[model samples]
Every structure is written in structure tokens, then in C-alpha cells.
Target: MFCYQCEQTMRSDVQDGCYTDKGVCGKTAETSDLQDILIYQVKGIAQYAQLARGLGVVDVAVDDFIQFAIFTTLTNVNFTSARFVSLVQQAAEVRNSIKDKYLAAALLKGVEAEVPMGPAQFDPAADMDNILKQESVAIVNKDHDIIGEDANGLKMLILYGMKGVCAYSHHARMLGYRQDDIDAEIERILTYLTSNPTDIEDLLNQALSAGHLNLKVMDLLDRANNETFGNQEPTQVRVTPVAGKCLLVSGHDLHDMHQILEQTKDMGINVYTHGEMLPAHAYPGLKKYPHLAGNYGGAWQDQQREFAEFPGPIVLTSNCIIEPAKNYRQRIFTTGPVGWPGVRHIEGGNYKPLIQAAKALPGFKADEEEKTITTGFGHHTVLGVADKVIDAVKSGAIKHFFMIGGCDGAKPGRNYYTELAEKTPDDTIMMTLGCNKFRFNKEEFGDIGGIPRLLDMGQCNDAFSAIKVATELANAFECGVNDLPLSLMVSWFEQKATAVLLALLAAGVKGIHLGPSLPPYLTSNLLAVLVERFDIRVNGTAEADLEKALGHAVA
Candidate 1:
């Protein structure tokens, strides 16, 4: 149950995590232990898969499974013990399948196969109780005292960063995209973890490399989303509910949302986007459906209250799920990698039962007065109007570009982002993604040179879109991104955001402001390295940070 993987993790002298009964996110010790064990088994699969890959023998199924299995373990993704228990066995089965292929390849080459000890060559119990008992050997802090906290912290960063990569890679694979190099890196890091290496320099370098892979996965995922759903365009979505049977879909999976939208189109049920799905409204294909209503609620952390009020069924397509409140537990459905104990799971992308539940429930009583929020300012929408942005900068209409983006959490310091967004000068524009924007998105900024000052570039999963737009803007101006009038004010919450931060670090992007509290897994030594090397800063007050970001912009 010892988990410090998210921004909401407990921290104190005697308690660095939720090792007691349940985590702050409501994950039980049983489920947490099973997640750790499942990760261990996945590493075992990687141990064999990497060897087989060397012989030019690769299994797409194994690579795909690796991504999916890791996605399930990410914070707020899955809380069901049975899901993890099933995945543990599934990971072992995948490992054995890969092991046989590795051995056969070695025999053909006349090289004796050597499957290492540890996760690679281990047996698991048949049930959940025994699986939890075996967690002692598989904990991330196994040598925290002996190897020192700094080394353990670096390893955890690598592990967590790799987990983010797995989640992103899985999203890309769902849209028929997966790279062999990405697969190799996934296995490379997993195999390294089996040894628990402690060299600080090696660990740090590997972490940066993991960041690079995360960048690749994000790139792949961006293409997958655009290719599948069509490039996002500017669209104003109605914030108020329309009268009808309704299903509110949350999370980062567009593929699932598309399927659900298609299946429920003529059923007289209205589907509204929640959380990360807000940007889905801008896609031409998704917005074509008249029943695809606008966004509802705030970020993931507020779901407990928000979900209870929504008049109909809700479907979570991916991570950032809270423990279901009993009020609407039966009406809630989990799809994709998202899971909750008693919540119904819509396997194989089926939404029939969910549609039925929505029909049976009392939806919004009547259409309310229209309230609208503009979204879908993704990379394409912003880049398509590049000349206007460049001209605005040249004409001195824009002083700086602030990317106030990242995963949102319910922690106290998170208010800094809301205030920062509110305090940005009218001459500057702010871009947002993930759930963080919910803080200040409703606050109007009007437009500059016909461009909205506050741009919503899809979800936190669309960090690539933000990165791509920045790089292209820099290119258009013939300057390094650092020399451009841009400052990345990132707020991180979970492993996916961690992976995004790593990508920025790996790309040598500097002078970025990151906060809402630093990760607990980063020891002071590692934090010092990031500060010194990357010039990353902790966020202060909104006024102070805004003045600082504006002051740093290159005119």
C-alpha cells in the first residue's frame, strides 16, 4: 500500500504514503499490492520480450499488452483487486509465451538461453490473498535504507516515467500505432528495474531517455487522435445541459467516446463530454453528431460531488476516476483501462447497456438557458492561424505566450494555477490542457488579433499538441523555443504529467515553472539537479510568477 505516485499522496514524518488501509485516492492495500505485483510480472514479460526482440522476433501482442497492463496500474485508473489479480496472471502467461520464443531463438543461434532470476523466473499464487503476501519482495523501496534515498528516488522516477510512457503508448496503439523502438525502450527500462541499480548518473540519464520515449509516444498518440477523429477546430460548446436522456463520458480515450457516440446517436440520449473529453467537441467528426452535447463538471478530483448530481448515467473512458459514491454507483460505467470495484465495465467498447441505463434514468428535466465555453484550440487550430499569432507578436499585441497546462489535482497549492491564469496580462495568451484549465477556463480573456487569448489544446494527454505548437511557432520566428516569448507554467498531478515534464527536460527546454508541489519521489539531490540543469522553478504567487514570466519574454 506504500504509494507516492500522485500529487495527492500523503506526506509526513511518519507517513510518506498511504500504507495503512487505503491510499488517499481510496485504493486499498490489497489492490495496491496487486498493482505492484502485476508491474513486477510485466517486467518479467519484458525480460523475455527484450531477448526475443534481439533475435528479430517481436510480438505485437506482447508489446500491446505491456502498454495496457501498465496503464491499469497508473493512479486513479483501476481500483478493483480482481482486475489486478487477473492482469497478474495474464502478465505471467505473456511472460511465459515470450520466454519460450526467447529460448527457441537462443537455441537456433547456438547460444544458451539465460533467463535471469527475480521477476523473470518467479511463480505466483493462484489467488488474491497470496498475491498480496508476495508484495514484500516487489516493493519499489526494497533497498531504500541500504542503497540510500537519492538512488531509490531516481529509480522511482524512472519507473514512474516509464509507467506514463506505457499509458501514452497504449493510447496510440489503440488507434493502430506502435513503434518497435518504443517497445524496445519499454522492455529496456523494465529489465533494468529488475536489478535495482543505484548509480545516480546512470539512473538520471536513463530517466531522461525514458522522457524521450514519452515524447515519442505522445507524438504517436497525437497522430492517432488527429487521424482517427480529424484535426480539432474551434467550436463553442454549450455548458448547460439540454433536455434528454444523457450519458456523461469522462477520461482521455477518444476512440471509446467515438464508439459510444455512434452507438447512442439515434437512441434519443444526449452525450456530454467530461474532463479530458472537453476538446472532443472540436473534432469535426465528433461534433457532427447533434447528440454529442458539450462538457460537464470540473476535473477528476471533484467527480465525487459532480457525478452524484448529473441526472443520468456516467461513463469513465480512462484514468482519473475517484471511488464511486453509493448514490450513483450502479449507473456509473467504466470503459477502456478505467475500473472501479462495483461499477459496471463496458468491455469491448459496447455502450448498449449504458445507453439503456441512460434511457431509464431521469435526465435533465428541461433545457436550461444556454451557457457556452469555447474549446478545441488544439495544435491544428492554433497553428492554422500561425501568421496571425506571429503578426500579433511582431506588432507588440502579444508580450508572451504562457502554457498553463498539466494534470490538475485537488491539493491546496493548485489554486496558484487558477490565479496565475487570471493574472496573466491581456497582451499575453494562455494555453491550457488536462483538467487544470477547469480552474480558470470559465474566466473570459476575449481575443487578440481574432485569436482567443485562452486556448484549450485538448486534454492533458494532448501535451504533444502544446509541444508541437511551441516548436512550430519557434521555427516560424526563426528562434530557439527558449528565445521565443514563451514560458511553460506546468502543474503536474500523476505519472502522465511526470512523463510530460520528463519530455520537456529531455528536450533541453529550460526556464519552465512547475508546481502545485513537487513529486514526493524526487529526493532533494535529484531536485537540485533539475533546478541547476533545467533552470526549473517552483511556482510562487500568481502576481509574482506572472511578472516573472512576462519579464523573461524575449522581445
Candidate 2:
């Protein structure tokens, strides 16, 4: 198996991906192959779904399945080969059902519906062994020889961007938000990939289109969260653990977090947010639960150590789950798109099993002293004070704005973000989101006047908030976003970050400094295109990049 979709992918001078029995994330070759096959089947579903939509027939179930299947294939989301096998079979069934709908609609219209070739018409084998042998068609690099590396790289970009789209869309759908137009566009992009187009310009444009699509999905999710849980406000969240029975809920699902908070209410089990769920504390609806305790640990990469040390049950609500260690394996539970071979999974939003596990385990021995950090400076809160911010900018009280955040990983060189945040001038305001904030969030940057210098904007999806704030600031300054004294230093990990990068480019934001390393899938030619078009820069030393953004030599 071969995979290089994440920042942690194995890389060397001679090799660019994980080509062995297991990947850096502990995903085995069999699991990787199964995920590939599942995606191929989802492509088949998209083939039919796109045609059906063209005939004025839309199946929400098919669209939902498309989002879910793609989301599960995201790095570190699901590593269960058996689960992927089931998903592959389920995808085929969903595709056939949609195919029947399309055929019936075409028959009613008295039009000949031509069947699409490639994945659209391809059939999978009955068993996992036979399925694994179908790598010729399922492998990501299958077209590397025929299409050349550059075009293949662009195709992978589009595919990975779509994965990010589906991940965001899945979260919105879970919150009971549905948009037919968004669903149609998702199918359109997936169907476009079935053709194996190699035109460099068109592939890049389509990749950017995925970015635009992601912007819409992010906006939908933002609205979903705000409308459901109330708009986020500035709130102080305790980062230290509290005493009593507790359950640590991680990942980026607010709905899951809310469910756990509700079910475990008054049950003597304290629910603590971890990882991306750190933003949940700012939501009024969720924070209303007194039993919703503080956060535990940092980002996803450090979970193995953190989870083992935490003295309560752990619940994974979404992506970024690693293989569980024996220390907490029995006490941890997986839900939503996250899964592991032996970990118990919570189905249908049920929390009884998870709550029981928490009850059975010994929680924290005693309550730790209250130590807190600030979050929830989303677009709404920031823009609400637009006048003050603009005034500060005019008076030179706020010299610049640095948006330094993205997915965090266990790789080296990530300390660049910490140092970058630290070196940001005292007069500048730092806006951050995603798990990457764990790097420098604890460090005190104080505030510029009344506004905090370091602002924690929600999760990775909340990159939408940054984009909105930038656009608003541009409008206030009567200039383009790039013309403002702002810089985007993005550290990407998986497909979600890819989608976010595309969105920034699609929005015409330029001069983004991206690292720890460029994607291995991107050939130098493709990288050249991005640099020439978008002014994208590989991150240098934190001090060097900070000086470049500030246009000065630091003392």
C-alpha cells in the first residue's frame, strides 16, 4: 500500500510515502487498501448521483452516504479494515439504489442514460482478499504513469480537498442542517474526478472549486453550531482537571459533546473537552451544564500519552484518533466516523455505555486548582468590536495581525509555530484556531489595549471565522485582504487543511506561509504553479518568517 495524505507520512530522500506494512499513523496496508476500495465505490455512487441530480432527482441518502464514506477515509479517522470492508459493501449497495433511481428518472423522461465508464461501472469483489488484489484501480498513484506525476498530484489535490469538504459537511448534517445546493455541488465535484482529466489548469481550477465549496460548507457548519448552541462568546476555560467521575471527550463534534454533557448530567460524571472540543466551552448552550468540566490534554498527536495518564474514560467523537494503548483501551469509546479494532463504539448518540465505563473507572483523585485560558474570539465577537480594532490600527496601536494555526502533529519542526507566536510583536494581535493553538496558547501574550493579543478562534472549521474577519477588515480598510497588514501562517496535517488552503487561495488571499513541509504529493511543477499564482511560501525559521511578515529585523 502507498499513502502520503498527511503531514506525518513517512518521507526520505529516496521514498515519499508509507510503502510498508503500516503507516506512521499505525494504519496497516490492509486497512489502507480497504479505504482505497471504499473511496472507489463512493466515486461510483457519485457517478450515478450526479446524473440523477441532472435529471432533477436528488437522493439525500446518497449524498449523506457520499459525505460519510469520504470522511471515514480521512487520515486517522477510521483504521478498522473490517469497518472499511463493510463500508465498501454498503457503498456499492447505495450506488446501485441510486443507479436505479437515475434509470427510472431517465426512462420517465424518455432519454437514453449512458452509463459512465471507470469507477461508475466498475464492480468490487466479494471478499477482502479479492478486494485487496484490486489495487490496480484503487491505488491513489494508479494514474501516476499514464497521467504523469504533476497531473496525478493535482487529481489527488482535488480528491483530498473533497475529503475535507465531506468532513465539514458531515458535521453540519449532524446538526440537522441540509442544503440541496451544497449536496449537488459535492456530487458534481466527485463526478468530475471519475473522468481522469489531466489538463493542468483545469485540475487546479477544480481544486480551487473544492476550496470554494468548503467555504460554503464551513459557513453552513458555523451557522449550524451558532444557531444550535448559540453564538460563541469570550469565555475562560479551565485547562486543568477537576475531581470526581469524569469522561474526556475529544475530536471536533459539538453535537456529540452536547449529548455526552446532557446524558451525563447529574450522574456524578464530569465531561471534559479535549482537543478541538476545547471551543465547546464558549458555546452558551453547552457551557450551561455545570457538570461539563474543564479540558484535558493538548492536541491529537499527544493523545496516547495524555489518555493513558487521564484518570477517567475517554470518548473519541471524530477524527484524529490514534491506536489505543492497553492502559486506556477498555475505558475509551469511539463514536461517529472514528473507530478502532478493539475499542467500543457508541452508536446512535447513545452514551450509556460510555457513562457506565466512566462510572466503573476511578476518576481524578482530587480537584486541581482553577487555571484557565481564553477562547471564542470568532468572527462575530471580533467583528463586533470592528470599530475599536480599526481605531487601534489607525493609531498604530495594532501594527499587524498574524493568523498562525492549523492541524498539529507529532513531527519535528512544529516548534516553529510556538516560536513564531512567541516572537510576534507585542503590538500585533495573533488569531489562531485548530489543535495547533496548543503550541503557544498557554503562553501569555497579554492584550493590545482591551483586546487580547492572542485570540483563540474555534476549531479547524473555524478557519471560516478567520476568512470572514479578514474580509471584513479588508472592507473596513477599503483594500483587499492581502493589502492589509495580515499574514496567514498555516501548518497543515490532513485533507481538511488542504481544503482550507484552497479556500484561502480561492478567496484570493495570497502570500501564505505554509509548513512544516510541503506535501510530498505535490511535484515541483505544481508547487511552482502555486508559488507563481498565489505567492505561497515555505516556512523558514520562526524568527525569519516573523521578520518577513512584519517587514523588519527583530531585536
Candidate 3:
């Protein structure tokens, strides 16, 4: 009953021993334990893939299997016991396959290590102490055991970062962007973790490599998105909730967002972006819908309360669907791998369930009778304004550009984003998406010339926007993206963020200041690799970090 897989971990020296009592993300010790086992098994699959590759065997089915295992362990994806159990069972099958093969090759060279079984495969499923004891005893290298709280903490960080990376790579493959180099790295690390736990330093190196690989994966995705959807440009998004009947869409799937907008159009129901859905307004095809209204709600973690306040049907297009309360359960629709046992699930590129639910729910009375939030300045739209942007910069009207965006959650310290945005000067332009942008949506960061300081790019997937904008800026200045006067201050909370981060790195963009906190999945060594190769850093503070980024102060 011990865990530390997030930016915030409970203190070890608490009087009540509260750290193990409650995980920083409100995860109970049991959930954390199970997640550890789940990862252990997934690593085994990676090892198996390595073995299969040496023998020349890699299949799409195996790819899908690996994707599912990684997705299950992602942040806020599966918080329930039932789903967790299902994931463990699937992992167990993969673990057993790897174990069986390893056993078969026991007499072969470099195959003497004892392969460990996943937790679900361990006997006495209800016994907790025995599970911990098994983990303690199964260490292949006594010299590198997670001997104490501190050691365990580092290992958890490395593992968690890998989980996020796996999730992103999985999504990119879904979009037809795949890289063999990344797959090789994933197999290599997974093999090492399951063959035998190694020294902290070695594992840390693997973690960094994972980040480096993620950069490649994300770059592929950025290309896939922009090539398919057209480059983003500066454009305005309507923020007013439509009058009579409204549908709030969330998550990172632009395909579904486009479908919903199409179905809801001219049907009297208004569609407003929510969560990652906020970026949909920037896509030409999607934003063309006059019914596409402004954004509603905040980050995923706040959905429990935010959904309750809304009176219309909500369509979750992807991940970060929290457990819903009874009051708003009927009005919420889930699509594309987002499932709540009772909530209506709309599948197969169809909007029938969502449209039907919207019809059944009490149509939302337009809340924006007066004020509205502006969004829709994605890369495509932004590039369209490239001339004006260049003119502004030449005229000394726009002095700085900050890519202040990433995922958001309900955590308290998340205010770092809000503060950073608030502190941005009038001469700076802030481009945003994901829930993190909500922090400054209500703030008054003055614009460059007539443009508002806060430019809302569409959802997390629309990180495609930032990538395109950077590429465009570099082109305008006749320099590489790394040489442009732009900075990426990202806050990650899930897999999509993983993909976006990778995309940023893959583009060879450097000196990204990421924060609120670093990811749980990166080992210290992995952090070093990222810092050395990509110069990525987690956020520190609004004023200090922002000033340094703006070249106004020493960081």
C-alpha cells in the first residue's frame, strides 16, 4: 500500500502516515498497487515484443493490445475497480506469454533471469501483504531494489512517465502516424523492466530516452493532423452559449467534434466547446458552423461540479470522463473509448445518441446574453495572419510570444498557469488550448495592437496549432523553429499531452519550460536526457519563470 506516481506525493513523515493513506491525486493505496502491477505486466509485453522482433514478428493485433494496456494506466482513465481488474487480466495473458517464452529459452544465452508474473497471476488475490512481499522478493537485482520510500519514489516517476509516453504513441498510431524507432525503444525499456529491475541510474536513462522518443512520436502526429486538417491560422471563435438547446463537447478528438458540429447544425441545438474540445473552433470545417458557440466548463478533474451546473447534454469525445453523479448522468454522452457503465455511449462516427440526448434534455437558455470568450486562433488561422503578425513584430507592437498551454486538472497548485497568464505583459501574445487556457480566459492580458493577448487554439490535438505556428514563424524569420522567439510552457495531465509534448520535441523545438510539475513517468536520468537533448524544464513560478523566458531576468 505505497505509491508516488504524480507531481504531488504525500509526505512520508506525517504523524498519521497520511501519505500512504491517500495518494496526492486522491488515489487510494490499493489503486496505486494495482497500477504498479498493470505497468509491470505491460513492460513484460514490451519484453515479449523484443523477443518476437528478433524472430521477425510484429502484428497490428499485438499493437492494439499494447495500446490498450498503456491507455488503461493513463491518468484519470480508469479509477474504478472493475476496469482495473479487466486491465490486469489482459496484462496477465501477455505476461504469461512472455513468461512461458522466457522459460522455454531458459538454457539460451543471456536468458537465465527469472521472469516475474503480474499481480493478477499471483495467487491469493485478496491478500495485500503477500503482494507486497512478492514484489520485495522478486527483485532480480538486489543492488538496485527500490529499498526505501525515496528509491520507490524515483522508480514510480520513471514508470509513470513511460505510461504517459505509451499513451501518446498509441494515439498517434490511431491517426496513421507511426515510428519504428519509438516502438524499438518501448520494447527495449519494457524488456529491461520485466527481465529484471535494474539500477536507478540505468532506469533513469531509459526514462529520458522515452521522452526523447516521445518527441518523435508527437512530431509525426503534428504532421498527420496539419496535413490532414490544414495548418492552423489566427481566427476568432464565438464564446456565447447558443440560445435554446445546447450541446457541450469535450475531449481531444477533432473527428468527432467535427461530426457533432455537423449533426447539431441547423437543428436548433448549439454546440459549445468544453475541456479539450475548446480548440475545435479553430478548424475551418468545424468553425464554419455558425452554431458552434463558446466554451463551457473547465478541466477534466472539475467535471463533477461543472457538469452539474450545466442543463444541456454533454458529449465527451474522448478521455478524462470522470465518474458522473446521478443528477447529470442522463444528459452526458460518451464516444470513442470513453465509457461510463450507464452513460449513453455514441459510437461509429454517429451523432444519433448525442443529438437524441440533446433533444431530451432541457435546452440550455443562452447564458451569453451579454459577454463572450474569444477563441479559434489555431495554426492555420494564425498563419493566415502571418503578415499582420510580422508587421506587428516589425513595428515593435508584439514583443513576446508564449505558448502557455497544456492540460488542466482540479489540483490546487494549478494556479501556476493562471498566474503566468495574468503576469504576461501587454506586449506579449499568449496562445492556448487544453483546460490550462481557462485560467486566463477571464483575465485581462492586453492584446498586441487589436489582437487579444490570449489566443485560444483548439483542443489538445490542436497542439497541431502550436507546431504549425512555430513552423510558420520560423519560415517568416527565415530561421529554424528553435531560433524563433517563442516558448512552450506546457502542463500535462494525460496521454494526449504526451503526444503533443512528443510532437514539440520531434520538431526539434528547444528550451520548452513545462510545469506546475514534471511528469510522474520520468526518472531523474530520463529528466536529464530530456534536459540535455531538448532542454525541456518543468514550470517554476509565473513571474520568475516568465521573466526568464521573456529574456528579462535570470532564471
Highest TM-score, which number? 2
Angstrom error of the Cα, residue 68, model 3: value is 2.5
Per-residue lDDT of 114-138 in model 1, one digit per residue for the tens? Answer: 8677889877899988878899877
Q: What lDDT does the true structure give each of the candidates?
A: 0.88, 0.91, 0.66
Candidate 1 TM-score, true structure as reference? 0.98
State each model's C-alpha RMSD to the native. Answer: 1.7, 0.8, 5.3
* Per-model TM-score versus the true fold: 0.98, 0.99, 0.78
Candidate 1 vs candidate 3, TM-score winner: 1
If ranked by lDDT, best first, what sequence of candidates would result? 2, 1, 3
TM-score of candidate 2 on Cα atoms, chains taken together = 0.99
Residue 221 alpha-carbon offset, candidate 3, angstroms: 2.6
Itemize residue pairs with steric clashes in candidate 1. Answer: 434-459, 434-460
Q: Which residue runs of candidate 3 sit more than 4 Å off their true CA positions?
A: 12-31, 93-155, 173-184, 195-204, 227-230, 259-268, 288-291, 335-353, 381-395, 442-452, 464-484, 492-514, 517-541, 550-555
Model 3 agreement with the true structure over 1-555: per-residue lDDT tens digits? 444344344433432122355455545555556655666656667766666555455544555667667665565555444555566666667656655555555545444644445431343243444444444332312223435433444455445556666665665666667777777777776666553444656655555566676666556666665665555555555555556777788877676777787777788887888777765665566667888867777677788888887778887766777778888988888765556656776767788877887777787665666455666676656777789998998888888888887777766668888887777777878888677777668666666767777888756655656776788888888999877667788887655565466556656778988776665445466678679988987777778888777778522
